[model samples]
Target: MLDVQSGGILLPVFDSVRALAFVGDLSMGQPTDHSLRTGWIAARIAEAAGLDASIGDTVREVALLRWSGCTANAAGFADVFGDDVAVRLAMLEARPGWAEAREAPGDAAALMRPLAQTHCEVSGEIARILGLSTSTETALRNIFETWDGAGLPASIAREEVPVPVFVVALAGDLEIFNRVYGLERALELIEQRSGKRYPAFLADVAARNARDWSCAMDEASLADFDAALITSGMRRDARAELIADVIDLKLPWMTGFSRAVAMTALACCARLGLDEAAQACIYRAGLIHGVGRAAVPNAVWNRPCALPAGAWERVRLVPYWTARAGKQTGTLREAAELASYAYERQDGSGYFRGADARALSLEAQILAASVAWVALRSTRPWRAALPSDAALQTLRHEVASGRLSGDVVDALIAEAGRSVGRPQKSATQNSLLSVRETEVLRAISRGASNKEAARELAISPSTVRTHVESVFRKLECSTRAAATLKASAMGLL
Candidate 1:
């Protein structure tokens, strides 16, 4: 299962570090080959530092995973930088002190302290779970550390740090900077930062061999990095599930949301008599469907009320990010596509592409229905859990309204019928929505006047007007008709 033929070289596909590096590359706003480049450079640095070749793979592993936790603290980063990817790219461009001194632009300690801690925690845990070396895990935990003990999460000073870890850190920066700038400028920057952020020795070696070292791994097609890793000997199959675990931790409430969705989606497919290949794809797709959630900030995702139009737009793009990252993992491409379609609706109002029912595949249809079924029964900040009957009514209502596929809905409802009360994962990230807001929006969509909406919702007319204004503003419309349209598009109705 690991072997894939790419450009006539048999390369292992999606091995742990290789797969994660692809996702990390996207999260860091670097190319998909970033991790591979860094790993190659780090291995060379290790060799030059007089380290033996026996543990060569460990050096590469550390480099590949240095930024593996990029997604874990993304919301915190986005909270300060507006766009997490942009902030990370900018942070990399400016070097070590940039965040606290300038890029943070807010309460740097308040925002960055937690983010730094989270990066180490998540990356270290992942390395441990993957059964990587104790040293590799240590290296990942200290990924942010500089030579002068300035890293956050922990500031373990020089001697406590392993030499290989230090070498890998320098290599990652060297590779990135070398790629962005020509070899000369890259060497100049490293020469400047020596003894401060990086050790002078590693910089000296990198500077001397800058040209050849930077281009050594370039001739190999990007697809072959996994092969090189596989040749180095690591397994690849369980990577999707492992990545799902990482994605699940992005939100406190969504701890096991993706696994639940995958399981439920598979039951729907199995009930409909789909093939095993189809079943496997949907299962994997469900596991990482919410990976995109990491790219969206908690400030928007954790709102206990309805989101404004701009926030909703950001919410819609979550699936796109997932698909983009997934595509980079060639082995997961199909599964990723299914995950991307997780939010599409039959009425053509769903986003990231707004693909209508005609454009959606059977897997997409089933995934969407399964996601909706799971979401409706899960509790959120805005409301109590919907009872089975109420959740079913809500789902059925969508099918009747031509917003979802009837066949897929029937299969999902059938699975629900067969299953007993199992714990549901948090269905959707909805701090950006309020139950009251949805109720009011639904009423308005049906052309209810403020007084009419108030009467229906058991609120005063003045209070209803306040909610109406809030809805109008959040949805970014000046009129009731536009609010109704936007709400329908957002599935708030």
Candidate 2:
């Protein structure tokens, strides 16, 4: 069932993750729905092949996570390949001979050498940071390893490799060929590569399971699978926060990024003396502002070349999704509307519903400045992270161009300086509520019942209930944890 609270629709975290993976696959050079569809296919194959449920679950996980590390070195890729998106698409189509051709002892070799090195190192780093299980980590590291030990660093041979890695790689390639070529051609290619680049047994398994694979490819079923896999929680608010983290994980440089932006927005709101409810809304909205990026392809996002018109249109849809995701939630609607204008220029140029300064909300204006500042500091395929001075200069340029408000820019610069001196705190602080209400809300945020909150706080269950009710009323909230997030944004607790 769709979870709804206070007229807010909350997508489950796993469902949200599936949405993210779908977005990543479509946006990046990987095949469309490749990871997720492959995951569904692998799960079915494992079931039919008599694997245990645990093994099937692991296979599914490995398939989803296998290519997650690809974005870690986007900046390096942009540097070596000129256009990161184009390079990835080419890599997808590169034959073994073509790959080797790029390494033939000259400028080509020098260029492709860094690309390969970055791919391996960045993949490993991303896997480690995401806290994948040891087995999952091993699978990601050896994903490019060939049966002949000709693939990449460490080049481990056939029998030494993990089974999930082998299965995932086969699934990924087969899906691509099936989409680009035909089903028959895909089968022929897999059959041809059996016992060479791919394991003979896995290839045979894929061929035998091709029909079932197609059955699993039904878009409706994939959506159901997403719903089934979502992490369970009491309210959508908790789920939303988890979704934010997953989205941020798409690129290594963006870890905890949305939270940072949200916090800064809240701080700015405080400095400006906005009301507590509006401040809370700004904080939550900031954390979710980049949710639309999931819909864009990784190639376009990391592209070094200027985007073509159609691709640029897709890029603009990101803000639309951000607003769309939050529109059903009353508390988040205003923030989402504001965030939709996050990319707007002070002079009126922006996208997905562009509005100039007169049309911009204060929260949106603040968000625009914060997002730009963070992007400047984050490594991208086109450029290295700028120094603070350079980032400031860029911000100043935007101001000059009327792309950003000068007041907003100045506030962000001040916030950036302050951030450097202090250890970063939780983006949502529990300060919006009073002490008693905060205590109740915190317990509620942890999924505590009124009775549970009372025991934790050493107060009567009735008193706890009253405080919970008060928190809801005071923060214009209907749920315990949303109130907690409000408190955090306000730094009251």
Candidate 3:
């Protein structure tokens, strides 16, 4: 981890990148760290083929951020295909010309073009907002572009595609194939798709050296795999926290809920005798366990009345999304998995899986109790915040009735006495924005692309995109128009 601590805070480039990748995986219906593994493969192929270190680094960054825009265009996707995740998974599995068929409610081109464009634009905007290089932004915007001009929205062919984009694209498919099939099939598939999806040169390279990449993927741990992608610079942790900030905005009253849960989880960890790595995992997992909340619509979350049967199923998938995102995050997989059990009960009464005592781990039990503790203390639209004593009594009753574990509830209550506060942002964080998001919000107000704001600010286009993304998340607005209105009302502009 590159500390590059400015003032008192550790630069969070690492955490933000990995966490975003994890969330991005969930967005794409992939396991967490899908991008991370792709990045590692891309970098190695670049190095083995003797591409410069800069190209390798660019590929890594591009791969990490490839799906950051998945949520940006989610509403558009849902508008066409009801279930956004299901549609995306289908699209990923679809072969060439599959979209030509009328499988959806609307014309595929009409719906998909805008969605793909939004995906590209928002991703590029994020890169610009984060101050990444122009090339990085270009690669991100062109991630869907391919050799044969048959890709989404833009459809730029071969030479028009950025080099890093080429590498990351091939690497992504190879990772999917290699993981799903054996090494030989992964290599053969690369050969099959060479002319159309990826460059022939890249495919040949991946095919020839498939074993090495496959071996590394088979052996690497999340910690080991991540350590290799380090690029020297002042990386900030703002984006990492900002992602959680966005996810929490799903419900109007859920502000700061993730941070509170994270703090309580860490507090409970002290009593569990967990190792430092385990504790850190628990904390990160808590922070992002709600990342999937973005998939659930606000109407369902804010409904004062009971959800209809249809709405109930979507509600059930919320924790599934969290666990899915966490499972893809190589390093945080354990913690993410544990945190997903937050809504579970010791008896077969919890949601999603309805796991009982035999299924839930000690860490999962602790995390669930912590999440309940925070929810009880926090104000919800339906009720006033529970008094501490009342909350404890209620939790105890749940435990006695076989809903929650007695040991976990008791430990959580005991941990409550040693109260801790949420982590604070540094005063040195960007000034005009007060929230690194304001810049992106302002850009949206002006109707600028990531490229436009990057030119004006003289920063990388990627940085602008990243900031705009953060703004959308922090403000909880989906469109530029909505974001602009929210910003003005809040006096952010």
- Candidate 1 matches the true fold with a TM-score of 0.74
Deviation in angstroms for 311 in model 1? 4.5
Across residues 1-493, which tens digit of lDDT does each residue of candidate 1 receive? 1111121112132354565676677678777678787777777787777777644667777777777777666655766666677667778776555565344556665677677766776677667656677877777777777788876656776777766667877787787787788678878888887886778887888877778876667776666565554423355333345566556544444544665788888888888888878887888788778767755555676689999999898899888877876655666777888899999999998878999988999999999988888777776656766998999999889989998998888888888887877764332234234677767766664446788889989999898888778887786554443454334323344
Residue-wise C-alpha lDDT for candidate 3, range 377-459, written one tens digit per residue = 87665677899999999899989899888877877877776554646455324333544466555544544567877786777
lDDT of each: 0.70, 0.62, 0.69
Query: Model 3, poorest ten-residue lDDT window?
Result: 1-10
- On lDDT, the leading prediction is 1
What's the residue-level lDDT of 330 in candidate 1? 67
Candidate 3 residue 373 Cα shift, in angstroms, is: 11
Candidate 2 least-lDDT 10 residues: 1-10
List the RMSD of every prediction in angstroms.
12.7, 14.6, 9.3
Q: Give the lDDT of residue 25 in candidate 3.
A: 72
| Predicted candidate 3, C-alpha RMSD | 9.3
* lDDT, residue 167, model 3: 89
Stretches of candidate 1 off by over 4 Å are: 1-14, 75-85, 95-114, 179-182, 215-220, 231-233, 236-239, 303-314, 380-385, 421-493
Q: CA lDDT of 146 in candidate 1?
A: 75
